[model samples]
Target chain A: MPFSFLLLVLAGLSVIAYRFGVSRARAVAPGRQAVLHSRPMYHGLYVAIWCGIPALLVAVAWVAMQPILVKGLVMGGLPDAYDALPKARLDLIWNDIRNLALGDVVRADPAPEIQAAAETFRRLYTIGNAALTVLCLIAAPLAARYAVRHVSIDLRARNRVEAAITVFLVASSLVAIFTTVGIVLSLLFESLRFFAKVPVLDFLFGLHWSPQTALRADQVGSSGSFGAVPLFSGTLLISLISMLVAVPVGLMSAIYMSEYAHRKFRAVAKPLLEVLAGIPTVVYGFFAALTVAPFIRRAGEAMGLSVASESALAAGLVMGVMIIPFVSSISDDVINAVPQAMRDGAYALGATKSETIRNVVVPAALPGIVGGVLLAVSRAIGETMIVVMAAGLSANLSFNPLDAVTTVTVQIVTLLTGDQEFDSAKTLAAFALGLVLFCVTLGLNVFALHVVRKYREQYE
Target chain B: METAILRDTMHTLSDTHAPEGEAAPMTAKIEARQTNVHYGDKHALKDVSLDIREGEVTSFIGPSGCGKSTFLRCLNRMNDTIDGCRVSGTVMMDGEDIYDPKIDVVQLRARVGMVFQKPNPFPKSIYDNIAYGPRIHGLAANKDELDEIVLTSLEKAGLLAEVKDRMEAPGTGLSGGQQQRLCIARAIAVSPEVILMDEPCSALDPIATAKIEELIDELRENFTIVIVTHSMQQAARVSQRTAFFHLGELIEVGDTEQIFTNPKHKLTQGYITGRFG
Candidate 1:
């Protein structure tokens, strides 16, 4: 039977089980619902879970294991001569057999022995699926009947259902955590491979970065340099410029919106300001590359000063504009969170409006604002599209905002976008960059959390 | 000694006795005549008239939503902070119309300080919390003078001895009673002519409430004090005069002893005797 058909059958059985459980509970209680430990709805849900969960698990397991089990059975029945082939050649033959079994066009006409193996594979797969359908058909009804029999006045149907829901919620959260760990582990392993070719200290501390390695021995630029210091410096410089622009503008705007703006104005204006954040970063990239970069270069030429066409200033300025809503929204919330009582205390003491906000409200909201700014700084450092389009990929170890620079993300994108062997240091270097970026942002987030925690205790 | 005087006054309460029968003829430090307050469409405070005498604790007592707190906030124009709140009629402070256009609100607030229901200390060191008012008003000429003002304010609020060693600690870190006292000290540091307290002891325990009540009695020696309270016994203990409000109208105003013992209005009698509010 098809998987969808099996699912539909399981669903139908669960519905029947639910109705049976509800009617059975009612029949046992007659007119005494108060005597039952749980309501009729919980009893119904409990029976449905018992009916559906076991059959669903069996179907899922069979679907996962059928191909491997069928292939194993087919291989055992094959001729002994096939076992002596190398693993790669055997894998090619297995691929051909699978294609032939599915009636797909194969590379060539197969031998009679291979053709027999494909037929055997097809037969085994059919038998496994048919058996799964029969077993599920029996398992659902039997489990549901056991549940119905157990549903007495003393049964804790609510507790059992609640426990099952809790297990589901835990499983959902664990998937996210495990995926994050899986990504970090994969990055770590690939970075180790890259480090084996290049020393860790050299990659971390050396100033030069030229990642092109010639495939032919006689080709130019054969000796590729993998020093990452320039990328780090460029990332830091752009992030610094962005923060310098973002912090004051964002914090002041937050203060104005939270403390000064009229209620109707604030209601309309806040979402409009957040619209800047909602604009796709890719759009911001083109805006930087096409608009601001040329403007800065022309303005620099008018001043009789040298400026790169793709300068860090343009990207940094645009990135800062992108981050304003992030800082402003979080700061605005924290500022608004500062109790009205604090402002009242200041105003009551003969202090002016400015004094109240400066001495009391801002200080009370400082920890949250600091946390927001740090998060924005990390976002600026990791931002790829804006820096990629506007900040040229030169990797210049310069602090001047007028000069072109390439960040870690830009370098990673440049390294991995083209056709390249997976095992080469050039391709694996992207994973190494990814690992370092992850660690830096993780450190920043941890530090921001610490600052918020330490200061929040005094207020609470 | 205070309780003896309170008991003696309660026993002698009569309608014939003059309201201001004390040896010294008191003058009104703050006076309101036919004052009305509205929040949006709601008539929060009706045309209420009262006198806050100089160097006296006059408590406003009523049930919740009776406009006692609203009247207290109106004294120093704290209502201005609230959006859509309108106030009309005259409020004269020391014979000057406080609602006049020329009067600077910032300077007026400095002269008429306030303490809130809950302890709202700035998230600053205890010393800074007290010195903030003086520094902004430029009351102290130097750092030593500022320190002196902070110490004396704390001393007057009865919090100096306990917190003298930790002036650097955040005021919010103090206990509930201590934080409230710190707020009182902060108000005192400005040397305001009047202090308005809106249910200042409502959030406190009995012991903290008692301390705040005692502090209010002491503060009355220098600053005119107007307090709004829910506890009738608290009004009898701390206030020299009491005003009862019901449904946004001033029901009665008299000497605290007379109001508690021989209330003239049936509504005042009903509220004071716990018959109904």
Candidate 2:
């Protein structure tokens, strides 16, 4: 049966269990619900939990194991020559058998022995599903009956329901944790493979970064170099330029909104400022590449300075504009969080408005502001689409914002986009870049949280 | 002492005997004439007029929201901070109208400092908290003078000996009473001519309140003090003159002894005798 249909059947059964559980408790209490220890709904929920959980667990386990068991049985009954075949060839034969059983068109014509195995596979699958349905029938009613029989004035149904919910909540949280672990492990494994092919030292400290390897030994200009120094420096230069643009503009706007703006103006202006954040980064990328880059090039030439058409300055400035809301919104919250009492104290001291904010309010809110800026920095570093479209792909290890440069995200996208073998050094290099990017962002987030938490402890 | 207590009680029960003369000399430091304050059409203070004598502690005693604190805030233009709050009529300080547009509110605040009910020390070192007012007002010429001002202010507030060793510590880390004293020290550091305290001991424990009371008594020797108090006994203990307010109206002003023992108005008599708020 489809899992959704099975879930619907269990839901119907639990609804019945809930009705029975509530009526049973009422019957025991005779004419007075006041005699029951817990609410009627809690008792119903307690019974529903028992009826649904055990049957659901069994059904899930059966569904998970059914295919593996059926495949094993089919493999065991295969012809004697299959044992002599190589593992890959045997895997192809098994795939044909399973596809034939499912009544899909097979890739190849099946021999008589494989045809027999396909019949056996279909029969086993039918029997396994039927047995699972029967087992659920026995389990749900038995658990529900037991729960209903145990219902009394002293059952503590609320406690049991609470415990079950706690377990469910924990399992939900573990899903997020396991997904993160799985991603890191995959990155680690692929990067290890890449390092085996390209020396780690060259990837870390070497100055050059052309990943095109020579297919022919005599191929000219294809001696691929994997020094990541240029990419790292390019990332740093762009992020620095972005921060330079973002911090002052974002912070000043935040202060004006929080301290000076009237209620009607702030209400309208804040959302408009935040709309900058909601504009897609791809749009910002194109804006940088098509508009800002050309404008900067023309302006720089007019000023007698050499500037690349696809420059880090353009991408960084556009990215900075894209991230203004991130800094402004967080900083607005931090400044607002500085208590009215503190402002009152400063004003009562005869300090001017500017003096009060500078000497008292800003100092108190400093740690949270720094933490917000750090988080914005992490956001800037992880951004890919902006840098990919505007910042050019030549990995120049220069600090000049006017020069063309590429970040790790841009290179990772370049390496992974085209058709290529996954096992090659070029493709695997993407995973190594991913691992480094993930680590840096993770460190920044952790440090930001620490700083924010420390600031909170100061006031409260 | 027993006979005096008996006679005071006898005088309080029958509100006919006029009490002794005013305890302080008659010299008005801040005089409000027919001051009417409105907060968005709610008449918070209605045509109130009173004199705050210099070099003496005067107390405004009233029920909650009786507009005593509102009248007190009007003295230094602190009401200007509130949205939609309007104060009319003339408030004269040293025979000059303070409501004149030429007068800077910042300078007015420097001359008239305030202490809130809750202890609110800035999130800075204890020394810095005291030095903040003087530094902003340019009361100190050099670092040594600044240091001397801070030390003297702390000494005046009676917090010097307890915190002398740790002037560099954040002012917020002190105990509740010490923090209140620190705030007092911060206010005095500016060398203000007048100090306004709004229920300064309301949040404090009995001992802390007693110490603050003692400090208020000493502070009156240098600066004119205006205190709003909920505690009738605190007003009688620390204030030389007392003004009784009820429902945004000043009912009577007299020596503290007379206000408590022989009130002139019915509302004042009712409030003092615990008949009704």
Candidate 3:
């Protein structure tokens, strides 16, 4: 019988439990009157919840793991000639076996050995599925009968239910925690792999960066240099410029709107500022590429200075505009959250309105403002489209905003975007960059939360 | 005392009071005549008239939203701080109309300082919190003079002994009662003639309440104080004059001893005797 049959059987068993529990409850052991306490329905439900929950989970786990376990056992039987093949080639053979088992045809070299492997794969999968279903059929009702017979007034059924729920919730929380740990561990391992192949010191300290590799054994200008210093420099320069624009403008506006602006004006202006966030980064990317870049270049040219066609200045300016809402929205919330009592106290002290805001409101709001700005900086650092479109692809290792430069995200975009050999150092470099980006952002987010939390503790 | 007590017993509420210049004249530091206040369509204050005497503690006792605080705010034109609150009355201080168009509300507020229910200390050092009032008005010539003012204010508030060592510490770092005193110190540093306290003891413990009440008595010697309180006991203990407000009307006003001992108006009696506020 399948697991569905077992569930139906348990449903039938619960009906029997219900009927028998009531009569059994009425017919207590000679002098033990408190032996049966709960209503018959509760006894039935208690047994049913126990039987169904564990059995279903077990059956699902078995169903998911059966195919992989069987496939591994079957693959172990393959000839040593097949076993000695490279892992990638073996993986391709397994893919063929998977496809054939799922009735997907493959046009690769068809040997009798390959055909036989496909057959074994399909046959074992059906056998395991049937075996697991039968196991579930016998397990659910026997478990339900035991729980039903044990159900009594003093049995603590509610306690058992609560414990089960607690376990389930803990398990769900662990899944999220494990996923985060897995991602960080993978990034750490791959970045370690990247560091092994490329010299760590040079990657951190070199001035120039150009990642290139030979297309064939004979064709190469350079083997490839993965000195990541310039990419890091470019990311920092753009993020610095972005923060320079975002922090002051965002914090001051948040202070003004939250503290000074009349209700009618705040009601109108806050949403209008938020509309800046709603416009897409791709749109800002276009604005930077088509309009702002040309304007900056012309402006620079009039001053007898050379500005790159795709200047970091244009990308940084647009990105600054892009991240303003992030800073303002969060800082605004924190400023608004500062108690009205503080402002009233200032006013009562004969402090002028401007003095009250400057000396009182802003300091109280500082940590939250810093948190908002840090989050925006992380956002600016990871920003891809505007930089990719406006900041040039050359890893120009220069500090001047007028010079064109590329960030980590833009290089990652250029590297892993099309058909390519996954084994190549060139393709894997994208993951390495991704790993680095993830670490920086994770650190920044943690620090931002820490600062904001510390600030809250100071007052309340 | 019997004749005066008899007069308090038979009084009924009237916005218009007969002139009390039988032998000489009555002197009022601040008087509101036919005062009415409205917030949008809500008539928050009915026609109410009263006087706040100088160098004495006057307390307004009423239930919430009865406009005792609103009327207190009107004395310094603090009603101008709120939007959509309309006050139609003449409030005179020292025989001058405080609501005259030429009178600056800011300058008026400087001379009529207020303390709020919750302690709202600026996120600054103890010295800065007290110096804020005088510095904005340019009361001090230099930092040394400002330091003296802060120290003097703290001493006056009785916080000097506790917080003098930590004068550079954040004002908000102090305890709740201490912060309230700091706020009081902040208000007093400017040497205002009149003080309005809006439920200043509402957010304090009984012990803190006692300390604030004592401070009020001490401060009354130099400043005319108007306190809005819910505690009848507090008003009786601290105030020289007590006014009972019910639903925005000043139902009765007299010496606190006589008013608590024998109130005339029915609503005033109801409020004082724990019947209904």
Best DockQ among the predictions, by candidate number: 1
In model 1, where do residues sit more than 4 Å from their true spots? A453-460, B1-24
> Candidate 2, which segments miss by more than 4 Å at Cα?
A103-105, A215-223, B1-25
lDDT of candidate 2 over A1-460, digit per residue (tens):
6677777888899999999888888887888888788887889999999999999999999999988888888898887778899989889988898889999999666788989999999899889978888888789989999999999988889888999999999999999999999999999999999999999999999999999976667877576888999999999999999999999999989989998898899999999999999998999999999999999999999999999999999999999998889889989999999988788777877898899888998888889998999999999999999999999999999999999999999999999997888998988999999998999999999999999999999877
Better of 1 and 2 by DockQ: 1
lDDT (tens digit, per residue) of candidate 3 on B1-277: 7555335433554322554223114357898888999988889887777888888899999888888999988887767667799988788888888888988777888889999988888888988889888988899999999999999999999999999899899988898899999999999999999999999999999999999999999998889999999999999999988888866767788889978998767668877889975
Per-residue alpha-carbon lDDT of model 1 for B1-277, expressed as tens digits? Answer: 7566334433333332335335237888887877899999999987777778898999999889989999998888889999999999899998899899999889999999999999999989999999999999999999999999999999999999999999999898899999999999999999999999988998899999999999998888898999999999999999998998877877778889988999877668878999986
How large is the i-RMS for each model, in angstroms? 0.6, 0.8, 1.5
- In terms of docking quality, model 2 is medium
Best candidate per lDDT, number? Answer: 1
Off by over 4 Å in 3: A1-45, A76-90, A215-217, A262-265, A458-460, B1-11, B20-26
State model 2's lDDT.
Answer: 0.90
Work out the TM-score per prediction: 0.95, 0.94, 0.90
**Candidate 2: which pairs clash?**
none
What are the per-residue Cα lDDT tens digits for candidate 3 across A221-304?
788888788999999999988888888788888888887799999999999999998998899999999999999999999999
Per-model C-alpha RMSD: 4.7, 4.8, 4.3
